[model samples]
Target: MKQLPLPMHLPARDGFDALVVGRNDHAVAHLRGLVPGAGVAAPVYLWGDAGSGKTRLLRALAEQHQAQGERIGWFDAGTALPWTLDEGWSLVVVDRCEALDAAHQQAAFALFVEAGTQGVQWAAGGRLPPVDLPVRDDLRTRLGWGHVFALQPLAEGETRAALRREADRRGILLPDEVLAHLLTHHDRDMAHLMAVLDRLDGFSLAEKRHITVPLLKKMMAENIHDLVPNPPPAP
Candidate 1:
């Protein structure tokens, strides 16, 4: 029942259905088969850079399975231990696999070995693919035993579509030019990009103006300026 650290402000639509698959449709399809009674195998691995939505996918899959009365254990690789693979765990999802230490690696290997007999399904995620993981050779090999997918980051057009969807959800009218500017200069990840909408909403309300490129520039400038330490007066 453990949970990974996710942004507290996640949109209400944080589920597999909301995932923007861009080029990862095959991987997403395999993930969908992990549900209980789906007759799927274990060690489904997904790797991608940070903010590529690996954690979100893991969380979404875990949540879906849990809702169906299945026992699910979710963990961040750094603190996750193999001992948690106790009895009655229908699904085990480990995120941040690149952070696992030697001890955890051995434990993960054991889990992989016993997955068939224990009736446990495995889904692990990391910043890199299995062969590139920092775990032991045996464990790394086991991680790739089943479906291994490299979740692709959103393309420019995909990011723009996501932004438009989020803006519509927030009941805000975002001009195409403003969207283009943010897409061009700002962080391209959907998670971070979507988060900007909340701040924009607040700024627009306080200033009594609709969202515009100039308004976003002003807000961003103030945010950056606030991070700077004020200079000391001449001593």
Candidate 2:
């Protein structure tokens, strides 16, 4: 099992359109509705395992909200800014809520309480179900108060489909052999695969070459230092 970067830059592939929903269509729908300020009062709580596209969904929605000139507050467990519900943010997205420590959990709970009163829309995700969340009990309950959808991983062929779609979007023609090599040697998850695509796109542009197996192999060799030998445990 070869390793690539733990996380590369945000993939150019995002938004509802970029997502290849299989069993997680319902989750996608609810999130898309949130982007348009659909009248669903309850906040959305999305739960899924790592590489299940939770981060992708959250970032996509945040981007949509930003595009509409809406005030959006996006927070990840690692970089949660100080937030107060009274800030008049239209949408608040909190990812990896389960990883929040005690102080951040308190801040999140405050935000949730204010969001309820202000009717601010919320889209959040965690690795664990709300009931099983390690955060404060009230916050856990609030996480599940609204629509809770468990995002499913892509089916067998969906990964390749996503790679092809992203390649098309970037106007790069990736060979089948390169795609097969990724599926066999690297992370099959869409997040990681998209990251590789992003790197490949940049590398091709910089090196003035088309995307091919040999090019990809060279890029992988050059990026071997980005690989994580022993990744941290997921929440």
Candidate 3:
């Protein structure tokens, strides 16, 4: 285990279970299986669409590894790569892997390949499927080598559960009617919903108002753009 100045619990910091509710179980389970089992050399690859919980799953994995006292290096492709060949051995959890160019991908693959032997595990999430991305044959082969898991979108019921859970965690009282109104009008993506919820929490606290349908209409209408689709352009 990683002996450190502080014993950080993976579940708490990562919000492991809370952030990834509904349709996250399958991918989470598959990634956990990667750490165990006598599998072929290589890190696990989680491929999914944006807001499909790929990044959340990756964080959960990295936190778990960190709790074990292992060093974990995170590479965010949204920004430039500070990664080099030497940044191995640590549990590598790279997000936005699809954003990395071909050359960088090859370099990352080479490092991960080495890590496989040194008892270093890697986990990464990518937007592009291996077949779709402009990648070297070797890198594609390596990415495909590990267990492939797809994070599916949350169902409507799952969506409701997620909303309720988020409200509870934030200690905000969101009634069912308000939730339904938000879900009906807003984008189906959880991230957007969460943002709206955050705004609601702030506005409600500011005004000392309860979160109800009437309150959501008055407050959200002021801050949020209409979720309803604009009328079709006149012919």
Q: Write the per-residue lDDT of candidate 3 for residues 1-235, one digit (tens) a residue.
A: 4222232212223636565456667667666655423343366788877667787678877766666665667775554554654443457666777777865786677667766766667677787776665667777777777777777878887888887887887777888888789878777776677767766776676667788888778776675444333445779
Off by over 4 Å in 1: 1-10, 80-83, 86-88, 110-116, 206-208, 225-235
Best by lDDT: 2
lDDT, model 2, position 33: 74
State which candidate, 1 or 2, has the greater TM-score: 2
Give the Cα lDDT of each candidate: 0.76, 0.79, 0.68
Task: Estimate TM-scores for all models.
Answer: 0.79, 0.86, 0.77
Tell me how candidate 2 scores on lDDT. 0.79
Ranking by lDDT: 2, 1, 3
Q: Whose TM-score is higher: candidate 2's or candidate 3's?
A: 2
Candidate 1 per-residue lDDT, tens place, 124-163, comes to: 8999998888889988888887888888898888878877
Model 3: lDDT of residue 21 = 58
Q: Give the range of the ten consecutive residues with the poorest summed lDDT in model 1.
A: 1-10
Best of the two (1, 2) by lDDT: 2
Greater TM-score among 1 and 3 belongs to 1
The TM-score between candidate 3 and the true structure equals 0.77
